[model samples]
Target: MKVPAPNDDRKGGRVPRWLRILLPAVLIVVWLALAGVGGPYFGRVSEVSSNDQASYLPASADATQVANLQAKFSGSDAVPAIVVYERSSGLTKDDLAAITDDTKDIADLPGVHGDVSPPIASKDGKAAEVFVPFADDSDLDTNVAGLRDHLSTSTPDGVTSYVTGPAGFTADLVAAFGGIDGILLAVALAAVFLILVVVYRSPLLPILVLATSMFGLCVALLVVWWLAKWGAVQLNGQVQGILFILVIGAATDYSLLYVSRYREALRDEQSRWRATWIAIRGAFGPIVASAGTVIVGLLCLLFSDLNSNKALGPVASIGIVFAFLAAMTLLPSLLLAFGRAAFWPVRPKFGSEHPQVVGPHAKGLWARVAGWIRRAPRIIWVVCTIALLLGATGVLQLKADGVPQSDLILGHSDARDGQQVLADHFPGGSGSPALVVGPASELQPMADVLLNHDGVSSVAVVAKDSPSGTAPVTADGVQPVGAPGSPPPEPTTVDGDVMLQATLSDPADSDAAEATVRSLRTDLYKVDDGILVGGVTAVAIDSNDASIHDRNTIIPIVLVVILLILMLLLRAILAPVILVLSVVVSFAASLGVSAYVFDHVFGFPGADPAVPLYGFVFLVALGIDYNIFLMTRVREETQLHGTRQGILRGLAVTGGVITSAGLVLASTFAALGVIPILFLAQIAFIVAFGVLVDTLIVRSLLVPALSYDIGRAIWWPSKLWRTDAAILASDSDPERLVEEQIDAIGAGGRPSHHHEHLHQGDREHPAP
Candidate 1:
């Protein structure tokens, strides 16, 4: 335990002082330039992003196929905006006149596609509706806002108006995600800054850490934005928000590990140059291993059938890669530039006695906890396991099958309110309709089949010559709304197929409507196997199914992939398996608790099937990070001090930094709740809670206790186990040997000469 002298250079070739200073300066300038360039892309992300659910489905999905074919028949993809005008009493003549005039005026607005449908009054005479179509390529939010503005100013007295349908919902969704670029980032950064300030009690260190995180995010966004603009990847608000949080959280966590190593190194090596190298060498293994685990785990999403899920894999992986680079390159340069001043007011003095080696009386909180674990390791792990299991039982109550599209946005929604109004007075699916595509020759048969279903209120076929762009199709055949003697309009056809629109008796996003679409597809296929049923409801069904498919398929793959990674990093089978199991249990418990809270406390209708999938990915991948940090150090210590003493020393030393990292990660994820989207909010709660559980309970108590109880076998089938066993066997009394080692460490002296078998290099420069 003889401490190295300050600024000592005798053990290696000396680096030129000028080069040392120049190197850090160059790196800092390079990062600053990169950050400056990437900064503006944050506001430009929406330019290349899309939130359309139908567009994210796989090409092989029925909904995707029907959507593509329907576009062919219409010659344009138009999103329908249903305008509903209602009076509690009855619609007056003035109301009808004003609605008709409003329809005409709306037709002239920019992006309005085709002809607007004439106003149709309901049988109750209390409500009327108009169908306005917007070209898909246009700015839906801008056009929808204009339409709403026009209605707000021109609506008849006492007649309330609402714009709701695919277009309206799209607009609202866009507005909800609008906060991602500004408010969300602000909240996440503020939370992280506060936490860093509290943890470090040093302003300079927090600023350096925040710079590393921000620079990483800026560069990552730059790459992702161009990829999206070039059509190489799809970007959406959800993916964008996740990328920001992931890069910031992962980068900060990595920075914390480096800072910890640097502080520890400075105590042993006074020269900033030598200290920087020592810190980098010590932190490099765990940081790279941690980032690799998360990146590889995220890439597993490529196996997901859902396009949105697949897009997340590479997008998040890019963020992780940049986070790794910023931590390894940018952060080191910043720290090296300032040296001990980076941690001003709490600078680690050279040759200072290390805390962990200072015996029981001088032990900090983590050391005290480690002592308690050593006394009753089995009981602690068993009790913690039972508590986690009990919490996980709530998973049965989780309603992750799917939620109504109307419920996707949290809080007030004009579109949701309008949908209720439309359902109360008119055919629930007046504006949104299930589309049926089949052979042109079987158009009548298809119409008849649709008409047979109780859920179908009416059916229509695309008609090029019709004023409304579609003519009503009944059991009798296509009906002529023109002059009595005029012939019915010809149905538009594409690739030997005809398209039929079936309006349902329930809202398009309703569970009833989903069932109706499912049955319609089943019944229609009986008549013609080539027939396909799709619409808003069908899109939800397919998206949910694909998400569920991804959850089942990708979860196991992530576990297997992460396990193999752990095995490689730890070089032990049993230890890796134990770590994976601990993380999985932690995920289950987090999801279980979140499910109960979402149902009872928040009154959440339900979750997207992908919610669990995302929670699992983030919690397991990110959650395992603390364990990796702890175990790698434990393994390094075990190589010198024997398993039991090494486990204690590792826990005591790593406890503070690992806990700080967990808090930083959890808080960054919690910031996702700022966006008023249900999926993101649910993800925020689940991941934030899971990281805490893993950090406080699993990593702190469960993993360490289990490893301690298992002893050398935790490294079973590895050379370390045999080497440790031999070290233990050579000592007649293991307990006395551990005490003697602790006393030697406390006195700043080497262990007894009898224990000279330990590696000299490791003795000189221990792993962080």
Candidate 2:
């Protein structure tokens, strides 16, 4: 092995020395500036985000139409907060008086809309409830906080008070999401950093890799924040958190591939400039294909009817784009600046021996695994496929219809507790009611219909002059609230339409309430097809329906898009089809396993419908990446070594880097659990587990062994398949065939024969 002179610049050719120095320096400075500008936007994401479930419903959804019509009848956009005051022994006179005073005090608050409802005592006499409406334009969380604080200090002795309803739930969701900027990012970055440190075992290299990820996130956030600010897209804590993780994980993964290539190039090329160029050229294709697949898969979300799902597409795609740019540009520049020092004690010296290429005798874990595959390719694939199928059977246990709103937050929740207390004392849907909008002429008929339903505890029609802003409606008609013989309050009418509010017999977030809403919509539409039903329960129903629709619609599109990309990438239809099928099976196994874990292991009540869709998008798109990484290298190796030997070499060489990359990505996604939101937590587990499955099993064994077993036909309809077959036929001896293939590809040196005896040993005990 010959070492080159330290000042060797022959490989740099006629390129100016100053120009090389200036290029990397400029890239570093530019990235630093962009990162500085975008860093602070992390803390400001909540400004443009809304957690209101109604806001995410598709515009064409029945709930959305009803929500739009609600403002016309009320003349104000307000979200209701239900305050429950409970005493196990029963509320005394003093407690009732105190509640009356609390309502008056709440009305004086800054964001209070119109009027606050006086405390209404339950028949059980154990609890009293007050409905407070907060103006939508005002700071809702702040107003809810003030109301809670006032009640906390002023509630009568021995009475428990809690603020829970749409507004309270919204406040809880906001608080849960508050960690996205600080804790979530810190946990994810810390996890990735620890993983990188262990993988590289170098101090400076981990820092460099993290710098690439951080800079990419900062720039991605800068662009996303502006897009959200301009109202071109919607942002939520969920989307924001995902963007941070995606950019960091993807940028780092891409960086790792580049680093591997750079180190390999450094061993062969003495000039640092030449090595950097070589590394970029080698890394550019797979990284772009990986990023493009993810971007297109994410973009497929645009077809989703749910706004949250739709918004995630472009927002996450933007993050991937920047991750690609940073990995391709900034990471390379930084690596160029550091050169051999980046790897520190383990730096690759020029002219050093490379890992033994494609042989049973190679001395590494992956090499050993490769040797095993060479011995029994068909058996390995058959057993792996059977095991994956067995694991996939657990998908039947998955309960992804949707979870109650109270279950959205994983831990303790004031809103959830209050909803229970409210349910025990009075109608379950006290504060949150199913809102119905219909023609004013059909008001009496609608009230009759509402009164006929078993699920409806009570019904009311909005009236401007009514003390509670809504008058109770009975089978007869709208009734007055003040005194007997008093005139009935006129129903508020907007463009000849009237809004009715029906309190359900069950909790607004309960599955029973959703069922009731569905039934009521069907029954109500029979009386008047123009009637629209919308509220908390309706919103949940619509969101779940859209998610299921998106899951069914987008999954196939993603498959087609990724399949085409793979075909173009591998230049072989059969190989891409096989790769896609392997990942699809892996995703199913992951979900099936996740379903069992979510049910029996963790005792999660149920999942949101979008959970599977999100899991598929990430697992399939990102999962396919490992296949791309493996198959592309196999294709490159095959051009020189024929199909059977190429699979072995590609697997051995890529095994370490791809596994490390998978760990990095899985760890980042797992960090989503820190947010205390059930949806993110579920997503975190599904993706994390799915990636490991893809890396360790599918990519490592199934795809490789299956392709190896098929031999050259995996590249059918391509010239390499025919060319490699001819080379294999020309010589019966494996060592001679390898030398002939090298000559066929126009290489300069005779192939290494140190492993010639190893090939002879394999030939003696040929693979079954």
lDDT tens string, model 2, 1-768? 667566466667678989999999999999999999999987777777777776468768989988888888888888888899999999999999988977788899878887788899999999998888898752787888888888888998899999999889998888898898889889998999999899898999999999999999999999998998899988887888899899999999999999999988888778889989988998899999999999999999999999999999999999999999999999999989999999997898987767664542367788888878877989999999999998899898899999999999989889999999999989988888999999998998888888899999999999998877889999878888788989999889988989999999999999789989999999889889989999889999998999899999999999999999999999888999999999999999999999999988889999989999999999999999999988988888676556877788788888989999999999999999899999999999999999999999999999999998888889988888779866444213353455565675476664445335445433432221
Local distance difference test, candidate 1: 0.88
TM-score of 1: 0.95
Badly placed stretches (over 4 Å) of model 2 are 1-11, 727-768
Clashes of each: 0, 0
| Residue pairs in candidate 1 whose N, alpha carbon or C atoms collide under 3 angstroms | none
**615-677, model 1: which lDDT tens digit per residue?**
999999999999999999889877766787667767877888999999999999999999999
Clashing pairs in 2: none
Model 2, residue 390: what's the lDDT? 88
TM-score for each candidate, following the candidate numbering:
0.95, 0.94
lDDT against the true structure, per candidate, is 0.88, 0.88
Q: In model 2, what is the error at residue 354, expressed in angstroms? A: 1.2
